[model samples]
Target: MSSLTKNLDAIRQNNKIGHFRYTIGVTLFGMQLINYFDRVNLSTAGPSMMSYFHMSSTEFGIVSSAFTWTYMIMQIPSGLILDKIGVKWVSRVSSALWAIPTFLTAFVSGLGPLILLRVLLGVVEAPNTPAGSKAAGYWFPLRERGLATALYDSGTKFANVIGVPVCAFLVLHYGWQSAFFFTAIMSVIFSLWYWIIYRNPRESSHLSKAELEYIEQGGAQEDAQPEPGVNLWFVLRQRKMWGLMLGNFAYNYATFMFLTWLPSFFVKTLNLDIQQSGFMTAIPWLFGFIAEIIVGGWFVDHLIKRGLDASKVRKTTIVIGLSMGIALVGAAYSPSVWIAVIWFTIALTGVCVSAAGFWAIPSIIAPTGLVGVVSSTMNVSGMIAAIITPIITGAAVDATGSFATAFILIGVVLVLGVFGILVLMGPIEQMHPERNDSNATISR
Candidate 1:
């Protein structure tokens, strides 16, 4: 048998969790938790911060966008670094670096300092998604990746659910600054935990021979360390890479709109108080967490068993989800507060449903050694949307005096995203031209 076949056979027979994989997943998940806390703390603190600084809605939007600008610029380079140095130390150091700025945000007395702090936070946090993608690529096989990616990605949604209410309470009780202080402390605690536990799969004491073989057999280069010869031009030239990049940008445009504005939307448009708005904003994310896990694992598995191509399966789900999200613009027009909330919830559910598949696409299309760089490139587009969406939404609110125009705009953009997925995202396989041949061989 070939090396790949031998590895596949070994993996199929091995059912045990190697201590190393478990530790890595746990550490990565914790980092993801901190990542979300640091990012979303700003959203939770928006109301109080706006009042304290006497800032305009546009200014608040700029503060939120600052992180994305830095993050977008840094993603590709950060991915390259992760590929070179591996995930362990990069993740540990980046976690602490971002956490420090988060802690310092508690001391910001004005918009200037707040924006500066957010930019610094973005610089440090840029490596997170790339690192997580690298970890998933190295540790898991094809079949389990969706579930594994969801488990890691779920940390962000979990933070939305848990962090919002907690931060709201802190803002209400102590003040907005206290909320930052609390999240900073949590980041510090998790960073220490990550450093002590994480290890590369090859170096991990817990991984079994069978599991290692399985990963290698599944076309993963876990044992084949990243070499220096990989070039950016090669990755940038691929049609598949562009497809993922554009698709991610569209998805994030919609996702960040909700992340940054949902709480504020509740407060201003729905006439809800801070605590009530926070809780209400969190409900959709709670549903999102459930959907991401279920769709990433069970739903995808069902498609695979039905003999669908992985790319087709992912694209189909995302297209449907984005189409569903387009209704949010209509939701924006609702007269009743409860009706608006329901529409927003449905829209967000569509965004989250497509998320896991988005991350998985990079792994599917990336060259064996360039997974980190490719994933980061794809995520950079999303981060750019993060920067721009807030500014646009803020502008729309300021110009229109109501969030209705902004919601309509966001809905229209989501529809455009569905088009991008169907047209720009051509196929899901890594080697798109050869996918037909692979399928034919499989049939034999």
Candidate 2:
């Protein structure tokens, strides 16, 4: 009886330290990735869809922009709604809503219905990043927050890595409609799993008291639960906020080019077959996913654990990443397709490294009280890039008869973002509405 009691006690202790929060974090990561798979699958399938509808490059651009328009419109509202209602409901509902439209896209034959369904999908999925950020905050302590944020936030690119190819394969083998069903079925299944498994530390039956106290004591705000009084106007006034917005737009302009146009570029520019384009397209994003997870999240976490100042750590990642992304121009000039893929892979790796830093910053800078509101505002700029880049690139391609000019232009935009960060951006620190915001960083 004594031995059995000791064995039982040891088992309970092991369970407590298993850090189930990491499990929840990774689940959100997977969910956000699946969200983006549904998003960018259209890019991979654009040729088939456009040919089927007898649409030009310009009209396809409109269809691509369809999701982003409503997605942009809903960012602010969705973030606040997630803050109020909590992650569980926001995530599950958003999944169902978007998944339904994704499913319906399979049945739509006309351009009008396709555009409308895309719009609805965007609106419903707008809560994705915001909810993932808030959920990261709830589950992770400060020390773990950066990596956790990066892990979930990198889902977009990570989706491109795996999701694009898989989606492309489905589109080819089973048809474009199958790509839609592939994502929808995955969404429904994951949302159900998330709804059943996820809960806050305080509310969770799986989390132990000792672990809960550890998180709450380590910069996790217990009082940040659903409440009121987030001031968006104040968020808009901060100089750093504007810089983030501008920087987001600039860098994402470059990034969105890949999301919306890369596969098409491969097929049209390099004369690859659909199968070759699908897998080749994933190559750069694969490098991106590796860099983001290893360098942005894991390396930064290692540095902080070694006693480096967190603000410097975050800023260093951002600047270096942006600088490296200038290589995108080289991709255009590469003499061959393989060489171009190498350049793009390098450029995207840089983007991923910096993106991990970018998403983590809002959590650190936003008043703990207003993370959702402020994050929504900053993230809007990224969606604006989504709205702009595809249409502009499509026009540029048609006008120039090649992607050369568009590639150089995208690199210039990313360089402008680098300048924005160096010139207009400030240190990574928590903001205070009551005082001067200029000198926000602390040496620690």
Candidate 3:
């Protein structure tokens, strides 16, 4: 009878759901949603804003790329800040502060002021990706990390799906400035909500002891502190880090190009008006969002839980998904609007699906208590590409009077990324800071 009682207790304990973690995941989703909304609005407003300021495509691209200049510079520092400070406060302060620049964009009258606000926006928003990574590492087990990462990362796609149309409506009815105001309001509200609700698993009153055990036993990084003796140079010296950086740079280049120029592509290249461009832009992203959640997030996690080799699964997904970026070539030469949308949708869906695996890699691979540093380091490479993609794309469009060359450039970059992943990202596993043996080297 005692043995039977013990078995039942074990079963019950295993079944505890720990509902609050999902709440945190959902909150992370909200933050990303708000982040991208602010970003895409500037692009959605591009045609109107350009016309208002008498700016050319190259000039507008400069404004779009301005955000990344500061963003790239701050990525590592933001990660270190999160490592020293906790996610709750870092997130709270960043969210509240980002809204100020987003709001002030509505009042800027010239290109200089507009550019300055964008740079400020980047400064404040730099912590978001690293913070999401840190929080996911803290709140989820290994098997669930992909889905948890997707839960927040997919918000980028969802924002494009919903935010484009909403911003278009605002831009059409009131003015382009209204879009900024709306996103800023959402950002402020989310800041307050996040402050009131978020806590590390150990500190949360809501997490049951059984659920907490399940999390820690399943390999959640619950402690929100950095390990001693780990330095930035130590992380930078890893070959695996460079591979992750290259992969991320390829992914981010394509993403930043699309974010800053997709609407304009519809407007200038496809000859669609703002409303048509807005709705059309939403279609590919809507599909991307759905794929991100289902294939990237849920399906990947489901496979890992079923005893598949986790590293193999993630690497396969990353390679295949990034390879899909080649479809941009097809989109570039597409003969009709529908055909173009179909191509872009295919490319973005692949990108989103792969993102589920790639973003989760930081948590899986970081040395103990250094997920933030690793994540930020990886992000810095991506931001370098992000900083330049818009400007380059704009120059290509202006020089050739077509977007074909720009799309081809992105496709080539992605192919290089796939090679980097295959050659340098040797395995998906944690690193030990104390290991001095060459065998302990993961990618090398």
Candidate 4:
């Protein structure tokens, strides 16, 4: 047999599962769920938070923007840190640290302190996504990474689906503070549990030889170890990297604006009561969760089966999803609340469809072992947009006394995002020239 066939056999032999890998994936997914719940609880509690603090629309915007601002700034450094120290300690520490501020938000009395707490929360939580991406990159093989990333990313939407209703209930019965406190405690508990349970795959004794072989044979070379030096300048100079980064930014500009402001829009503009608003706010995200799971897995598999190039399949999905997101602006202008909700749900479903495809690109295109850095870079751009869009939307609302202008602005950005994906991203296999044909087959 040829050397390539022999290598494939060895990899397959190693790709077997034991109990430990399953535990790690579960723990990581839980952490992601809590991470999202903490970020979004503020949205569910927006009305009460406004009432409790007597905050203006602009003040609330600033408060919400604090998390994204800090999270954005920390993204690259967090990725670098993960690369150097590995994910185990960093993930646990960041998770535990973020929970402190989440718990303390219950005690905040004024806008100033609440904003400060959010900033702290952002700082601590900055590492969560990068750490999870790094862990996935390290543990899973190419074929599995898309589903892994989707499962992890879906935690965000799932948390929104569940946490919105739960938080709304807590705020109505106990108080807004109770919502924060509950989520905070859950985060802390999970952080500790994760630390106790997780082990790096290299160090894991329970992994079956078959599983290890599968990953190795799947072109996931362990030799691509994290280097001590990473040149941000070099990373930035790559046009393809910039394409991914900017594409991510455009995608998030609309998403964060919707996530941060949608609840308030329902209450203030649509005249829904808080409970009704919360349920309505959750509809888009619930649909988005389902879309991500189905599209992220099924779409790629279908493209591969049809003999489409992996890069083209990925880019096509992104273009379709982003173009669909532009419809959200029309949702904003709808005369009826139900119509608006339907439009919003459809738009977000599009975003979710694209999201899984977009995330899979990095894993497929990135140089071996650079998935963490690349993923972090792309997410940092998205977080930066997340930081600014809320504040800008607030200013727009303040200026116009309506969310219509803000929604339109976000829609335009989403349209631009479509172009970014189509023009800038080029081909997904460019970064891994040696394994191009092999990856294409697996993708198929």
Report the number of the highest-lDDT candidate. Answer: 3
Per-residue CA lDDT of model 4 for 54-159, tens digit only, reads: 9888888888889887888888888767766778888878877877899889998888899999998889998888777767666666555566667777787788
Which is the leading candidate under TM-score? Answer: 3
lDDT (CA) for every model shown?
A: 0.78, 0.80, 0.86, 0.77
Superposed model 4: Cα runs more than 4 Å off: 1-23, 221-223, 226-230, 430-444
Model 3, CA-based lDDT: 0.86
lDDT of 1 by residue, 314-398 (tens): 8888887777777678666778878887887787777877888887777677666677788898898899889999989988888
**Candidate 2 global CA lDDT score:** 0.80
Q: Which ranges in model 1 have alpha carbons more than 4 Å from their true place?
A: 1-23, 223-230, 431-444
CA error at residue 415 for candidate 1, angstroms:
2.3
Residue 18's lDDT in candidate 4: 44
Lowest-sum lDDT 10-residue window in model 2? 435-444
* Residue pairs in collision within model 2: none
Task: In angstroms, give how far residue 320 of model 3 lies from its true place.
Answer: 0.7
TM-score of model number 3: 0.95
**TM per prediction:** 0.92, 0.92, 0.95, 0.91
